[model samples]
Target: MISGLGLSTGVAEAEVESRRSGCLWAGTSHSQGAEVIAGGWAFACTADARGVPTWVPGGATSQAGTVPNPGAYTDPQGLFSPGARQPGTSYTDYCVGNQLVEGTNDVYQAVESGGLVFWKAAAPISDWNFDSNSPRPEPTWRSTSNCYRGSLL
Candidate 1:
């Protein structure tokens, strides 16, 4: 015999958005076919008649980092092409660098190669003032908001 029992139900809300508003801007590299998007915006890096990569901001200009280069490398990995697979290694070696904390000048990129994708982000070592041994003040993307929406199973 079974007593009165039932499964409990509740609603879980989820949303997705860009983690960092400007830490890294989204733009295409000067390649034949490469597409990059961030924060629900498409960054198109078009080339001029002379084959120079140009920055085309889809939504808003990024607060920090440099404009992306299109098609420069076949496998764009952390600071190095064919980057490491571990996310932590890439983030630390490139994004955070030797700095104690993450900086805004850090730039990130997504590369697709051999039917696989790689991600990398880095901040310029020069951005840190050696004399003071402190990181330069710049806008950074700590985390994204509203980037996903679904119910937890």
Candidate 2:
């Protein structure tokens, strides 16, 4: 019975669990107030919406006041690179040290395709810290284009 922006009614438990299993943190979008999942030691993105997806440079925070990576970096040479070279279009290279949780450095990117926008995030390294009690999963990338419908929901 989970209800919120981008989530359809009757969402299955398995689906929710799957999303949770892979994400280090999942919550709402900072700018659009849409739900988002991040920090999974891999790249992940949400499905396309009816309208353009809002990119929050400051990243999103949880209800508990916890802020994730907050979109601090940009990849000019990699995928999800913004259009044209411009100020505020690039950021420091994202790495494990930039993550909210230790050993969970992941990058989140939003892109447009087929008249829809999608979010992408990934954590490229594993075992960032040998002493970390909980080792993050292997580096990976994922994207979901159907997770949102637009600013309307």
Candidate 3:
């Protein structure tokens, strides 16, 4: 799930849509074999286990630079602490430099809500500048409502 695909339908219907439509990066859908740059990485719209269009790792974009550390990273707030990982869950996290948060290099978690996906600080809610008009308890960190902004983390 790349997030913000607007696929609220059941799995069967989504599977069919995946075959018909190409891959969806943020929210906007794209045809098969399309390439997108997300979070400083180059992603190619590829097929998944069920042949659903997915963002596959093409390579690191120039903006990505080098991965701070190749292997897994340890968040200051203990993101990788012992027993932090729950059973039967799939997630991937990388070292986010000064992109999301200003100046301070921190670890963020990619959480899904609605048809959109956004990253929030792994440290605490206090570190963020909340949107005054957001409807949820946690503020929406996105720049806009549209899913595909390209510059989003």
Candidate 4:
């Protein structure tokens, strides 16, 4: 195991082949240290489903001690699903250009680019009620209340 903020040490490395999982399991023993005070760090390995080592973002000695992707990385399966998640639900709330939204279930990804949010789904939520767009007259408490109700919660 690699060492870092989580503080982990590799004690043993063994390969176990299994047809059920259809891969070689590299059993590793790790010793975790106490809560870190400073120098927070994390560690991960690059390996295929099999015990064989695969070239992942970061390898033991790949790219002069630099990982392939720093801020982002893709999974073995070609899928790019990103977004803010709500607790205890697969449902995600996507955003568009910093405009928060309630997303649907079709597309499973959300991305923020150029100060705007984009979704992979075909359709997105399209209902915005600004304070000025309230039905009530201006300077009226009813208008303000209507605006708040029209807007998201």
- Most lDDT-accurate candidate: 3
Question: Between the candidate structures 1 and 4, which one is better when assessed by TM-score?
Answer: 1
Report the lDDT of model 3 for residue 42.
56
The whole-model C-alpha lDDT of candidate 4 against the native structure comes to 0.24
Query: Which regions of candidate 1 deviate over 4 angstroms?
Result: 1-36, 53-55, 60-99, 103-153
Predictions in order: lDDT: 0.30, 0.30, 0.36, 0.24
Per-candidate clash tally: 20, 22, 0, 4
lDDT of 2 by residue, 4-35 (tens): 66665555765545433322222322232334
Cα deviation of 111, candidate 3, in Å:
11
Give the alpha carbon lDDT tens digit for every residue of 1-153 in model 3: 436986555787766565456653322456677765433455566555555344455554544322121111222121111111111111122223423323123324433334233444444323322223322232223323222332335
Name every residue pair that clashes in candidate 4: 1-10, 5-41, 97-116, 97-117
Candidate 1 lDDT tens digits, 53-135: 33243553323323333221234332222211111221332222223333233443443455344555533433222222223
| Cα lDDT tens digits for candidate 4, 39-135 | 0122232333333322221112211211111111122121111231111111233334434443332222233344333334432222111123222
In candidate 2, residue 132 scores what lDDT?
Answer: 24
**What's the TM for model 3?**
0.32
What lDDT score is found at residue 16 in candidate 4? 21
Candidate 3 vs candidate 4: the TM-score winner is 3
TM-score of each: 0.23, 0.23, 0.32, 0.16
